[model samples]
Target: MNPVRKRRLVITLLILGAVAVATALSIFALQRNMTYLYSPSEVDAGKAPAAHPFRLGGIVKEGSVHRVPDTLTTEFVITDRFQSIPVTYTGILPDLFRVGQSTITTGSMVNGRFVATKVLAKHDATYMPPQVAQAIAKAKEAHRIPKAAQGGGAP
Candidate 1:
């Protein structure tokens, strides 16, 4: 091969290799930081990661909020109408956080309860996060399927 052509080919290969490495690193970092959202039903069905931080989205069950005396720690239950998961958070809740409202809590499960690091409540009565809406819809569908099956009919 000619000297100039050989040098050009080597440089091209080096650049491509560097690009590949950078892309791979970027993907790895994203994967590490990625957080998945799950509904109470999905978590009850053992679909959520037990050790990694994830977002749990659902409606706050009616009359489920309880605050510990003289502490920021609060406990509540998040439900998808079909299932519910107990969540414990030790921080100031959002102003909109209330019973029967949509919320998303970021945390990990420990000893069968979700230990939340942050809690997010829906901004308005008419607005819900897309993931939370989808999860609620899915939970409703799942709940209906069982009833239809028991009635000996297709859902």
Candidate 2:
């Protein structure tokens, strides 16, 4: 082969290889950092990862909040009206956090309860996280469909 052609081919191969490697690394890093969102019902149905951190979203159940005296620790139950999951947090909660409000907690499941490291509350009465809203919509749609027609209802 001519030396000029051979050199050009080698350079092209090197550039392509570098790009492939960079793309692969970026994809792996993103996969590692991504966390999923799940509702209380999904968590209850074993859809959430137990060890990896994930975002849990639902409305705070009324009369389910308990705070420790003179401490930041608090316990509450979040619900989607169909299922509820208890959550524990020891950090400062957002000022908007309260019963009957929508919230998203980032944490891992331990001993049947979610241990949250960060808590996020909706900023306005009408605001809700998009993932949470989507999950709620899916739940509502599932319930609206007849069980027989779904093939998993009454048999």
Candidate 3:
């Protein structure tokens, strides 16, 4: 092979190899960080895998928060009508982290406690997690569907 041609071919192969490695690394990072969104029922039932991280989501159980002294560490319970999962986060709570607010705490279950590294509270009292709102709507509709099937319409 000619010297110039050989050099050019070598550089081209190196560039293509770099691009392939970078693409693989990007995909690996994305897959690693992606986690499942867990409902309260799933957490309570131990349906979540211990190895994978989770997003513990539900309504903040009313009157269930207690802040420890002089620390940002606080404890609260997340509920989904049928069950509740306790969560602990050692950081400043959002202003909306008050009674009856909806939230999604990102972390994993450790020794029975949901160790939340981040706590995202509701935008407002009237605001709720979209999943919570959807669940509520579905519950209301379930009853309506049965009633309508039996009779003329739902009251």
Backbone clashes under 3 angstroms, per model: 0, 0, 0
Q: Return the TM-score for candidate 3, rounded to 2 decimals.
A: 0.55
Candidate 3: Cα lDDT at 150: 56
Models ranked on TM-score? 1, 2, 3
- Residue pairs in candidate 1 whose N, alpha carbon or C atoms collide under 3 angstroms: none
TM value for model 1: 0.58
Specify the poorest-scoring 10-residue window by lDDT in model 1.
146-155
What would the TM-scores of all predictions be? Answer: 0.58, 0.57, 0.55
Error of 3 at 84 (Å): 0.5
Candidate 2 lDDT over residue span 1-155, tens digit each = 99999999999999999999999999888983564478998888987877688999999999999998899899999899999989999988898899888999999888889899999997655667888888887876876785545544421
Distance (Å) between predicted and true CA of 5, model 1? 37
User: Which ranges in model 2 have alpha carbons more than 4 Å from their true place?
Assistant: 1-36, 124-155
Which candidate number would show the highest lDDT if scored against the true structure? 1
lDDT values, one for every candidate: 0.88, 0.87, 0.82
Cα-based lDDT at residue 132, candidate 2 = 84
Worst 10-residue lDDT window for candidate 2 reads 146-155
Error of 1 at 81 (Å): 0.7
lDDT (C-alpha) at residue 106 in model 1:
96
lDDT for residue 133 in candidate 2, whole number 0-100: 84
Q: What is the Cα root-mean-square deviation between model 2 and the actual structure?
A: 9.3
lDDT of 3 by residue, 3-102 (tens): 9999999999999999999999998888735654677888767777789777888888888888989998999899987889888999988877777877
Which candidate wins on TM-score? 1
